[model samples]
Target: MSNGKKILIVEDDSAIAEIERDYLEIDGFEVQIVDNGPAGIERGASGEFNLILLDVMLPGADGFAVCRKLRETVDVPILMVTARQEDIDKIRGLGLGADDYIVKPFSPSELVARVKANLAQYERLRNRGGAPKDGSELKVGQIAIRPQSRRVYVRGEELTLKNKEYELLLFLVEHVDMVLSKETLYERIWGYDAIGDSATVAVHINRLRDKIEENPGDPKVIQTVWGAGYRFKA
Candidate 1:
């Protein structure tokens, strides 16, 4: 039943790493483990794996540093595994190009689900990017999204958007004028509601606004709906 999809697990904790690997393997994925960030970087950059499970606390370099470095050369989904439930840590990891996160003490099934979700979503994005050059280019206000190229532009200036940030923006634009709740956006973009955290949505929204809006402080395009959520104004 193996689908030929490979995964890399970067964790110093052998027990936890084994648990993750066991679950992913049960779901038919080929899994590899690296105990530290330095070795993680070398293996991750080789682009052999379809996804990576990165631990936050490591010896050589922290997960944040590893995620940042790996993102520089690897586009594969990087899911941070952390015991820290602090919002700042989540914000930092998401900001550093990690595709998603799985907290410690999480159910092995949930870990597998998170991995599957990130992988499924990543493949969808990759397929979209493989479309012909004539694929529809979305434009709203000064924002432009070229799905075929997997690029976004604001006011004629290209922007570098991490995976989740880009997906949130595109989803909002596609549903322009509709207020999407935090839970809704989280479930839609991150692929689950079980790990629902408003900070996840807030962080990515702020990131998108920072890249797309003329003034991120008081945004005009992607506006807050007071008690509702956010709406991309067309």
Candidate 2:
């Protein structure tokens, strides 16, 4: 059985951190707050957090760097927070392996809502069963995916993929040869249509290619259909 959820808040601003922590704690989550990127990474590596609320602008390393490092060791969901409302920043955060993004001056209620939604999705995936025993793995040339186990194999070697990445890859594989629009993908995977920017999908696609494609510069498994969206070739 899953225990009480643990959330890590990585925000340099004490006020914002406190506000998020207070609300999440009231919702029955255990919250840990860290002020800088390096410290956040250190704590995150301990594998204690079920989810992370990371601020974009942080002291000593920045949220992107922290997120990248944390992904190297953990599969916890990361929700990036930023004061900048630019699409480029959101894309950057997603590319660095963050699962979601929220802009500053956001409604606390909405933040809590997102947290709950993400946690629910995570739990659902966790409770799902293991991979099939038959040779029915989704294979895209050299890359193979087992949906039930949430595992990816590249040339027979296991590849570590975060929760969102694995889901995105599986979705694309399941819909092989069909060009899926970014809006559709966002709505399906995130449980809501992405607002303010669609570059978040682009970033994730790029990251997924980097991991699964032998030549990310010219991806073959997950192809981008110009003026449309993305598709799986095999």
Candidate 3:
């Protein structure tokens, strides 16, 4: 599932981290283990890792704080590990920019799958949709996306987009006008839904609209289909 791609595991539990490392290394990924939140934040923001597996309960900073700090500058996929079964914890992690959450006691195979999925998604976005590219700019309504630079523009003005927001927009634009359900969008974009909730997708959609739409309150570019999902009208 990997080709020397580096993954940082920030877990205080040595056993869990070692198990994760062994599985990932066996899959051809380079693994780095950090036992604290501060170190994780430091290394994770260095732009050296393709993905990060962060634990919720950590010394120094905790997963939530580390995630929030990392999201300030890092766009890499963050998979949170938590033992809490509460919906609030999962929701908080998602809201804090975690790409996925794995509840503790998850099987090693499942963890590997989640890691592979997030890494693949990250690679797709980084590689400009992973197709042999023509370096073309995709235009939809007033928004423009330069595949080469992975940059987005709105009405001739550049707009900064977060990782998930950009991925969501690109996906919608590529399948423009197609009514995609939440489940489809979530799976295609997120790759995994440990919490089995689509709120993260909704959050990203709103964020994308806010960045690319003329007015987010009444979005025209990305239209919401009540009782369904969303469509890229633009």
Best by TM-score: 1
The residue-by-residue lDDT of candidate 3 on 54-126, one tens digit each, is 9999999999999999999888899999999887887788778888888889999999999998888888778
Q: Note the clash tally of each candidate.
A: 0, 0, 0
Q: Write the per-residue lDDT of candidate 2 for residues 21-119, one digit (tens) a residue.
A: 888888888999999989999998899889999998999989999999998988778899999988888888887788888888988888987888777
**Candidate No. with top lDDT:** 1
lDDT of 1 by residue, 45-126 (tens): 9999999999999989999999999999898899998999788898899889888887788999888888888888877667
Q: Estimate each model's TM-score.
A: 0.95, 0.85, 0.86
TM-score of 1: 0.95
Per-model C-alpha RMSD: 1.8, 2.9, 2.8
User: In model 2, where is the ten-residue run with the lowest total lDDT?
Assistant: 189-198
RMSD score of candidate 2 (Å): 2.9
lDDT values of the candidates?
0.87, 0.83, 0.86
Question: In model 3, which regions exceed 4 Å deviation?
Answer: 129-136, 192-196
Off by over 4 Å in 2: 1-3, 130-136, 155-157, 194-197
